[model samples]
Target: MSRRALRGVLGIALLLILWEGVARGFALPSYTLPSVSEILLSVWRQRQLLASAAWFTMAEALAGYAIGCVAGIGIAVLLSLLPPVRRGMMPAMMAINSVPVAAWSPLLLLWLGVGIASKIAAVALAVGFTVFLSALAGLDRVDRRTIGLMRSFGAGPLSILWRLRLPTALPLIASGMRVSTVRSLIVAIVTEMLGAYGGLGWIIYQAVVQIDFVSVWSAILVASALSLAFFGLIGAIERRVVFWR
Candidate 1:
């Protein structure tokens, strides 16, 4: 592994060792905090169930992420191209974005019912604003001089967007997308915890009710893995798509 990767692995290892030592030294109860070994064992034993729940959660996260990215980028492009619409819509969008996803979850559950739709909507809502802000800022970062230069060469709004603004905005847009991967999964899981057919969040909820804290941790571990994988996937894609960076 590279130096950075090695350091990260070592840091995580040290943390796990410290965690194990504390749990063993204090003789902590499983309900309070199980040792690393216990959690790992629990994860292994319940891998099948955890895997199924993870798959369900990942599906919701991925679907919502795609929709959010598309909608966010599309809206940013639309507003960038139409200054009048941007002026009119910016305040409304900001007002909506100021609200937390948790605040919207209950209402979404009521409106969409306790299904995958609600989870997807919550994730999308959380992700859309993040991406929209980033993309809009990036799109606006181009110089007025550059835009005028393009216009002088017979470039219309669409042509300027396609040839100049979009390229200049790619880095910020990709950064936003990379950041939103984790948010998408988190929002989906949180919404699922509120109500869901099956997901890591649902598993965690059930485990909590049963006083199975180890299972809860196991589900959490699985969710963390899923989030990391999603984040890595986005990072990889961003690296490829934003090759200039």
Candidate 2:
């Protein structure tokens, strides 16, 4: 492994060792703080159930992520093309975005019901603003001189956006997308915890009620893994798409 990877592994190992030592030394109860080994054992024993819940949660996260990305990019492009509309709409969008996703979750659950729709909507809302701001900033980053040159050469707004603005904005857009992957999963899970038929969050809630801390840790471990995978996937795609960077 590379030096960075080796250091990361070592850091994690040290943390796990410390965690295990504390749990054992204090003789902590399973309901309070289960050892790392106990959590790992529970994870293995309950892998099937955890896997099912993970799939359900991932489905909600992925659907919302897709919708958010498309909507964010499309809106940014449209607003860039229409300065008047952008001026009028930006404040409203900012006001709405200012509200936390958790605050919106209850309203969404009430409107969309406790089903997958609420979770998806919550995730979408959280991701949409993040991407929208990044994309808008990126689109606006084009040099005024470059835009003037393009216009002088008979390049219309659409053509300039396609050939100049979009390319210039790609790095920022990709960064937003990469960041959104984790947010998407987090929003989905948090919304699921409020009310969901099935998900990692739901499992965690159940475990907590039953005083099953090991199960809670296991579910968290799974969620962490899922988030890492999602983030890594986005990062990989960003590296490929933003090859010039």
Candidate 3:
């Protein structure tokens, strides 16, 4: 591995060692704090639960991310093509983005019920503004000369969008997806914690309420792992797309 990668791994190892030593060496009670070993053991014992919950959470996060991406790209294209739409709606979009996900989760649950829909909606909302802005910026990055040349060639709006803007904007879109994937996962799990009965977040809530610190720590670690894996997948795809750039 590269030196930077090796250093990162070593840094993480050092942090984990510190955590283990502090918690275990202090002989902290299970309810107050559990050692890394204890958390790992608890996670092993609850493998089935983690697997099932992970599937649900992954589905919610990915589904919501897809929806948000579609909506953001569509809106970006429209806004780029029409000045009025861009002027009238961008501010409102920004305003919506400013609202905290915590405040939105309960309302979504109330409107959509305590089901997958609510979780998905929350995740989508968390990612939508970010993706939208990325896409808008991408569109703005299109070369004016290229656009004029396309226009001079008698290219229609759709043709220009498909042949020029989309390709040019791909890097930005991919960057947004990388960010949104992680944010969507966080929102999905948090919304699930608030309303849904199944997911890593729900498991964490249950652990906390039951005073199962080992389980709580295990759930947190699993959630972090899942988020990292999801982001890595996006990063991989991004590298493939932007390789020539």
State which candidate has the highest TM-score: 1
lDDT of 2: 0.95
What's model 1's TM-score?
0.97
Q: After superposition, how far is residue 182 of candidate 3 from its true place, in Å?
A: 1.1
Order of candidate numbers by lDDT, starting with the best: 2, 1, 3
Residues 20-126, model 3: lDDT tens digits: 99988999988887788888899999999998999999999998998888888888889999988889987887888888988999999999998999998888777
Every candidate's lDDT: 0.92, 0.95, 0.88
Candidate 3, poorest ten consecutive residues by summed lDDT: 122-131
Q: Candidate 1: misplaced stretches above 4 Å? A: none
* Model 2 Cα lDDT, one tens digit per residue, 127-203: 88899999999999999999999999999999999999999999999999999999999999899889999999999
**Model 3 stretches with alpha carbons more than 4 Å out:** 1-7
| Model 1 worst lDDT window (10 residues) | 224-233
Best by lDDT: 2
Native RMSD of candidate 3 (Å): 1.8
